[model samples]
Target: MSEGNHSSVTEFILTGFPGLHPEYYGLTSAVLFFVYFLTVVGNATVLFLFATNRSLHKPMYYIILNLSVCDILFSTTTLPKIISKYWFHSGAISFTACFIQMYFVHCLGTVNSFILFLMALDRYMAICHPLRYPNVLTNSTILILSISAWTIASALCSRLVIVAYPLPYCASNIINHCYCDHIGITMLACTDRAPYGFPAFLTAMVTLLGPLAFIIFSYICIIVAVSKTAHSQGCLKSLSTCSTQLIIISLYYLPRCFVYLASNVGITFNADVRIVVIMLYSLAPPMINPLIYCLRAKDMRESFLKQFRRITIPKKGQVSALKKS
Candidate 1:
């Protein structure tokens, strides 16, 4: 081993699911395909609805659009590799591919976290300080915040690629998860700890816990304000909105924190268990987020159904003309 310089890792073997048991490979492929398919469709629906519907042109929906983009990016960052792992019965990823996956996955994950915080704060302003909501969450401010959120997430999480690349992995090149992730890469490091560890830790805290705290605090104020509101209908509406956002935040963060933070806690000792947890962390949120929005949001529900019907129902004049022709 060289003293100061490090050799680049040529490739990484992903050991998630033991390379998909021969008997179960078909089942695994089917299941993962379905999940990835739904994730794409669901997030795409959100993007389309928000884009086409002029009524959804508010700062809140603008934020939702940003979140949808993040979700789509999040799913994209890992799902293809997951599919390849399952279908090909090969889990080997090139070092370059691994780094790219890790970078984008963390970037999207952090963006989602900050966007959720922004969402909670939006709700807080709308509910707890309605009079000041418009001025505070203006279009310009929302754009600035959204841009800042992506930039910060990308900058913060980029260190994983920077530090993890130089680590020696002569002993083992196998990553114990399907998708490239922090833990998977960290395990490849010959040293138990490295420059990667602290940077990864700091990025996780900044991207995960910091935004989580902001969301929780914002929702607390939102709930209290809702409780004090005199109008029952208004209170119900506010509660519904806050509850929906809370559920999404939970879906996004809880699994992530469990898998990432538990690395040090000894709870994620089993590699198989860790892989399962990480897969859920990757697949579940994108699946659930659009459902939550469509179910809880009346406008979204109406627009979705309206668009659905518009595509399905044939025009009466067109039908008659076709019959005549």
Candidate 2:
């Protein structure tokens, strides 16, 4: 493509949930809005509970706090615009804005992957090596690991953004999905994208698979250690402790792997189906994570309830005034 053509596209139009009937737009928008709202509230509740409850300040809860922050940020970065697109029919995004969205969407995702890996390690240590767990995952170490997750994710994603930023988008300006992403945006560049595409793909795979491998290994070790104890009750308790994290890990990684594999292997899925699957993995986890932690982790649930009661209880003066009335 000529330079003139390359410079033509200043913005891109996002085609969200293609192949859907026009009548369903309102319904889809409403659902997305509800999900986004819940995501924000749920994650915020977790953050608030974590912040106010000093007893909750430990390595596990610290990691949960980080994960909560990541979930909130990730949902904020992607959902509102897509909701606008569906609700208001405002789908055009400036070129720079699109790239910014693409960057954060992937960057937060990478951070979440690493956070989950860290959580898995936390669990493994707590379960498999209880004696050394506290020493190994001290508060300082947790802070460093949390910071490192964000830093490493940013550094890795920055390379992709830097490489894709200058590429000329002469081919088309319509992103087939709800939001701008590395693959969707890069495929629109008219230049030979192989140079950028291959590296980005490789980075993505490593980002997705590397921590996943560690998480799996950690869980395997956990299972083995639990099994060797010869106490069924102990084994059950250990599995119960790890179950929530395992559910979240599966939710975070499996659909992503399936989507990537399906796309690369020439397997054809309906466009709408593909987009919904993407949304499930990307959006659902953030919305469900807080619930999982609160419901599955006894400590978190009790702390939240204790805080709620403190907030809602009537003062002694108010109780006397009510009796007088």
Cα lDDT, model 2, residue 101: 95
Which candidate number has the best TM-score? Answer: 2
Candidate 2 global TM-score: 0.95
Give Cα-based local distance difference scores for all models.
0.80, 0.89
Worst 10 residues of 2 by lDDT: 1-10
Candidate 2 displacement at residue 153 in angstroms: 0.7
Model 1: lDDT to the true structure: 0.80
lDDT digits (tens) for residues 1-325 of candidate 2: 2445458898999999988888988899999999999999999999999888898899999999999999999888898998898799898999889989999999999999989998999998999889999899999999999999999999999888888888877767999898989988998987887787778878888989999999999999999999899889989989998988888899889999888777656798888899989999999989999999998888899998998777667576688889999
Which residues of candidate 2, in runs, are more than 4 Å off? 1-5, 315-320
